[model samples]
Target: MGAHRRKGDGAGTVPVGGGRDRYFDALRALALVRVVTYHAFGWAWAGLVFPSMGIMFALAGTLMARSLERPAVTVLRDRIRRLLPPFWFWGAFVVLAMLVHGWMPGWQIVYWVVPLGDPPGNAWGEQAWEVLWYLRTYLWFVLLSPPLLWLFRRAPVAVLGLSLAPVLVLTFVWQPPDDRFGTGLWDLSTYLCCWLVGFAHREGVLRRLPPVAVALLSVAALGYGGWYALAHQAEYGGYDLDDDPLAQAFWSAGFVTPLMYAKARFGFDLAGLARFRRLDRLVTVFNARAVTVYLWHEIALVLAVPLIDRCWEVPAFEAHLPLESQWFMFGVAWVLIGAFVLLCGWVEDVAARKPPRLVPGARPATPAARMAP
Candidate 1:
């Protein structure tokens, strides 16, 4: 949550000053926006829909790394409490909603309850379960963080550097054809790099890198990322972008880490140029509700899709008409907004707000206890 000291009087807008970590809010908002738009309109910006999560990994690492003074068990507990309950609620809701809508094959409630419904084999894989993958992946990362912290404390940069070679060798050079690689944890490697780099970012590593050097690296990565994009764009006859070698190159833990680090550390604070306080407040609101929005947004769309598909048709005079491309995109946007707002309002009181210890030596859900991500 980044340190912050509330300033000014109660009657006035809470000045987000005094070293408040607005960067995290900004980063989190980035992830939320990317995930929402990617799911709602995969074709809108298909090649670039890669999530801001790698940055999130970096942020989580930075946060966890900073909190290394705390017991590992405490870190695990707070993370679990922050992540789990909403998951239980929404995961269960998705299953029941599917049953009512006749989308599921049977009354198998455990699939949703156990957090195992969206396996790699599922039709849409984890995306079918919407935001559950974050839960699974994040929890896994948190559990692994203590050991990682030990290694990181020893030689943070070198360890992070070690990550890249393996990524290139496994995800690129050798290019395992099967989706699942050596370990079940392969998909998480790049994300972990981002997390660790975020830890590095916390130590002022990227800021120390000369701007020109970082710019050159950015240019090179972008070139690689672009080439990756062109070779794999789904719009140009491919079904998915993941198959492209260059795309794999672009997505490598190595490629993304420096770029993410550069952006996080070096992104200019031109946000002051934003025209209105409304816009600022709106962004903050989005950040506050990000988790709720992520969890329930698809459900909102699922509920609205059928009704909207049957009942509403955009008239020609309406902007971006004919219900495809931009208009379909806009409709999805509105649906997502409504869903996000409603869920945020309902869940604000409880989401990520775990109570104090109910017992000695016992904390709320800890480690990989409740989280999937």
Candidate 2:
């Protein structure tokens, strides 16, 4: 979530009007960390632990709604401008790698630039680039936000209440085709309600809701989502919510609702973080390089494997480090991720029209006011 001001705002929705909204900033940082951890380890339970995609979309939706206060065209342009450069910079490497591996070119290749649909990839690039699905879905959301926000504002409660209908309809009435278009449709529907909840949060609709009602609704959604995921694990091959969009949608709704509402209703407190300068700075860096982190994490993990294998050959590393452990790989992945952040993260600064830095949130030689972009 970008930022909005409200009295009594503390944990989840710190007002960005005065400064950075540390709460949402931390959520995004944690979500990005979870995404990398899940992919690195393939933990089925991780989805239940944290529905990162839903949370990310909700955060983005909140930002989008806040941005829509300006001209829609301008907002859209700024968003695309912010998104595409980083993507193109990342895609250039992946696309070039795919071409070197003999990936044939076709019109679908255009998606590498615009990503209106899923970008084509060779087998070697699949794992590294499959995460592009989120980018594609986010692009779609950005494209659709103008109309969605319009309808959402007219009857915020009613529209937000019924926002899950598209996913429900897609789940039961008709299944999407097993193609790129279907993939996009399923992803869009799966996260639509979360996105709308973001809108509600931005406009204070969530803040105004009765606490008991919000809690009950969240419980119902979580209960059903959990039950559905568990019951259908066999059919889906595992209980990962990502494998089942309906469950993910419901689970994310349940999980994210109270969180968005709690900022105003209960003031989930995070102000103590100010006492830990280094920890606070890490959170700031995470938010600043979110795109860079997301784009490079898979490759980082992939690189971690061989590096770990080489380490196994070194007796010192082999005896001292748990080189065989996935946890160890997770650690190595972050190290590589940090390196990538240093090398390529400047694209984000350029996109944001800020002075480029090797790492975000590093103390400047001279003290200067830190402001949220």
Candidate 3:
């Protein structure tokens, strides 16, 4: 515990307070936009997003490792608060969208709240309760980190080495069963590996590697992910339903790790972007309310689809659009996404406001710190 605490202080370099990590927040914003564009356009135009999303998850894994320094219970409580409140609020928006569109009866509202809106024929229509997949998986990752850290104390390098070796072999060799949920739904297991990799990162395994090591690895991983997605586009559509275990393993081990390794070391650079501080501040506000944005974006999509149908002769957004007009679809999706982001931003304060600041002396922790004797 003592040494780990030092790691928490030393290995942990990011500052606290603003709850704003500009680079990482931009990553999240980028990933969500990619998801929106893909679902809107349904093609490889969003090729880069898959690896980008992996980077965000690995960074999250790092965040969980460091946050464990605080009382786990307090941290867990805040995690639930920050994640669920906005989810609940946006959930209501989804229900309202269904009601407005007359897609379902008003009395069936409870199903939406419970997140079991599986229609008889199409299960994918289940709205996933508005980006709750990431939140739920992230919560699981946070819950599981303490034990992973406990393992880190005994055999850090060997554990990572062995885990990576088998997964690598399996990724190139096996295709998972698509009919059943086993390999199809990698769930927390896949992302868990990435999270633990972050813990290994904190253990100083990665620091010893040369700068070009991760960069070269990132390029290799990106190439593999692109070719893999292209090879299986017919069966998997660039990804294996986000459920296939084997594909999930490839994503985490082959695709995700390289991105994490790259992102941690400033492997990429952006230039001439400094004149946009005001633009960045607005984006900062958008990120601060990220929970709200994730919650509402889907509902906005659901509503926008029908409204577009009423206004235009073309009723279909996903199925029958001309191949040449993909950019038009992309623009529409961004407009809807932007609208939802702003609407949710207005409601963010109500949900994401941290538990009231310690009112003077009545706060939970006292000012004086006593060393562990």
Candidate 4:
């Protein structure tokens, strides 16, 4: 998504200027901010409040559906091209840092080049590498999207239900497997529902549902998800969604489905003059550099931890400061994120085949202009 269209415009359309939607750009930007904040501060409520990962997958799914208008091979090639460059850049940096720190490079290191599975991480890069699961999962989704889309188009409800069945079984009937591939597959099963919901959205299937029907389904999903979360709270050690995969999956579906309905019914509009223009530009920049920001923000936060700790160690600062405060770390994380964005954001521009800019400044051409030759 980019700030190149009005809220209700279609995702895949090719207009005179880029045809990205401001609503999606803003949502994605907010997701990026929320994820970075949640990671830095350990905010338990963040998952419940936003379900950022689900939203992100849904957004990607919509874009993927749009991309499929072209040949599937072309779409796959483009997806890999756009996705892998930034990953390769970051992976190379991580590898270099690990090698310099005396970690031996081995066969597992090959995973960095093509991270179909989670790569082995050294002590220095473990925190940074935690985010790679998304990359691996996203890669799988992209590879599978053509067939998935075909299945979705043929039988939307059946495809959607089938996607969710694995999660339900693993959550209730069968124990989820403990191996890395098994867990990764389990996670994929969970998010696939959200992704297919996105496909429904792109194809106008979601919009066809009566508002009452949407609301009722949402309530049922939320109710079951809530019951599951409460029942399994002890199993998870707390209300932390990350610890309970089933709850996380159900709750995310509950949250994302209704939001998608709302987005269709009443788009996300930045109201008023003062806020709109400022937010427009900010969202533009964020969407343009989203991949870079997402990939590097954790590393920034990890790096900032020592600086914050050093600050706490200062005798003058120690007594008055709450070193572990989430707000405090959030501020520090943003600063570091800004720095990292400036350093590496050009890669996103290059990957997108757009001219490199520190920030995106182009605005969507008007509808009339878009209709012009």
Candidate 5:
């Protein structure tokens, strides 16, 4: 994921130490923290403040475009291998748990294997498994990227517009389908533009734009998003952009554009933290174990719910606490999340083919010596 350097693209060259971007790592680490924190607390404003999903998809798109320099099949295989092992580990555990709790094993269970669509879940596992929609969408993006890249290289603007058109039509002009598969398809359509923006970033299209044009585009997008949010608040629930797919698409583009610009121009500097080796190690661990963290955090939250509820049942604890308070529950969730990471995070290493370590450094691994086939 741009962890290694490639020959071309001087503008995007990796910095001295090993070609890793601390800025991207820091951004990703922050996004992960925000997503976990928001999910734990159900903070509506958090979605507004940080469009974490959009930022993440954009980041993945940049990496996918970089990987596309290799054969498309190789890229797809490598991406799937990196993704599926940890998912399978987690999915298998959850499914078995559900089965033990009396869920019937059936043909639909096969969806858990590839998960191109959302897998069926029992009452015992539904909340914990809801996040798989992201993985399913990501798989589709990876599958479509080779052809998308080809089109982007040929006609960048047309391709981007085409990617964005469906979101506008679906959100504004036509009614989106209400069923599960239709809803999933609509979600993919809504976010594909953000993904394409990543492709644009890798292609240096964003960097090439005039600063004024970039700023204008960002402001216009945000303005439209704000208007859309306010206009639809009566129909939807609140100003939360997540309720309005079109607003989310617009707002996310606006939110990510400037950060991408800053990354392209200034990049993140860690020289000031030259003495903070432990902090550096923590960031490395967070980035390396990101998939593990994302996969398990929700399950951790679900498990924490009972413990927090028990605290509420205690007379002394209930006396001072508001019935709606989730602050303590949020803290408990992070603790469990950390515990899960330590217990099973090694699967991410195995999936990536990296040697297992609690914390990995920023260096790229040397290629293993090969034997003649």
Candidate 6:
């Protein structure tokens, strides 16, 4: 999840420089690219390099804080409206596939509609729906934001430190039970600090902090998180942040703080992308249909394997193509991703109550001048 860009007045015009923060949009686009790439290749160091999930949650938290300026009920309604249509549309195919593969139905099927818990799925659909953990965690954050924001306003620094306590307790004292509810709590605790940092950014708390204090705090967090992951790699099987929630929480908190602080304190912006119109437009589209991209990317990668296998049957492709390469599969995945954007992405537009469009941010053509009779 990232900053939710509200639709401007124009129905189909490409998002330009005005009225939107291209910086956040660009961050989201890059984070998404990193997510897809990491999944495709399974690089161990990918999380350390970018910590995309932490960045995403922080961005979402910032946006949530901004939106909460309105009535809480209205904000919550609009947020859920924007999120669920794309999820429901995506879930229909996933759930159907699971049933066809003989997944027995339990009352837990209700979770699929609202996703309050882990939506039940069979082994076959595991790869596709595993990403739902983020949505579940995000939903929890959204539901809890009013109190969180109110609490933060009362004691900014203390609440921010206290937010990390759950993860520390989970790590040192008791582990979450191996159950759906426990899993949800673990996920929520892991990123809660990053989420609060977003609140700090929006409230100008980060901006007011001394740069040296920010740097020192960030470095210490990163150092401890990295050391913990490396030292405990044996227990978790690898230092992959996903495997170790404690490490992930600390690492992401460290990684995201400086970036958010910089942006909050300085006027760090990606407005320069306006000069490269095509690239800016691509970022705009990615941000516009971010949910669609995230929900469908796993399936796209899964399809890429079979599609590439078909290429091996063709003599010309077999001879000339690096068909066996993961890079090739990465290319195929994006091709499928682009196709999905065209096919299913329009649902996002409809969910936003905008005109359903083939391309979310394509520049509207100028109206032809009337010919004089």
Better of 1 and 3 by lDDT: 1
Task: For model 5, state the Cα shift of residue 34 in Å.
Answer: 0.8
Top model number, lDDT: 6
lDDT of 6 by residue, 230-346 (tens): 999898778888777888888889999999998889967877989998998898888888888888999999999988999989999999999989999999999999999999999
Alpha-carbon local distance difference test for all models? 0.52, 0.83, 0.50, 0.74, 0.75, 0.83
- lDDT, candidate 4, 1-373, per-residue tens: 1000001011122212465566666677778887887777676777777878888888888788877978999998887888888889888888888889888867887778887877887777777777777777788888999999998999998887677788778777887556557657766877888888888877878888799988887777777777777787777666666656667777778788877776666654343322567777777777777778878887788877898889976987787877778778778888888887788888877887878777665666899999999
| Deviation in Å, model 3, residue 336 alpha carbon | 3.5
- Least lDDT summed over 10 consecutive residues: which range in candidate 1? 1-10
At residue 323, candidate 6 shows an lDDT of 96
lDDT (Cα, tens digit) per residue for candidate 3, span 1-373: 1000000000112324433455555555566565665555555444344643455566666676667778888766766556655556666655555556555545445433432231111123344343444554565666667777778758876665554444444455654443223221234444555666677555556665676765576466456645665567676544532423334444445556654555445533222233476656544544555555455555555665565555456556335654235565456656775676565554445444644321111214444543334
Which prediction has more favorable lDDT, 1 or 6?
Answer: 6
Specify the poorest-scoring 10-residue window by lDDT in model 2: 1-10
**TM-score of every model versus the real structure:** 0.70, 0.93, 0.67, 0.86, 0.86, 0.94
Candidate 5 has which clashing residue pairs, if any?
A: none
- Candidate 6 regions exceeding 4 Å error are 1-18, 369-373
Candidate 1 lDDT (Cα, 0 to 1): 0.52
Q: Local error of candidate 2 at 199, Å?
A: 0.5
Model 2, stretches more than 4 Å misplaced? 1-16, 367-373
Candidate 5 Cα lDDT to native: 0.75
2 or 3, which is superior by lDDT?
A: 2
| Local error of candidate 6 at residue 114 (angstroms) | 0.6
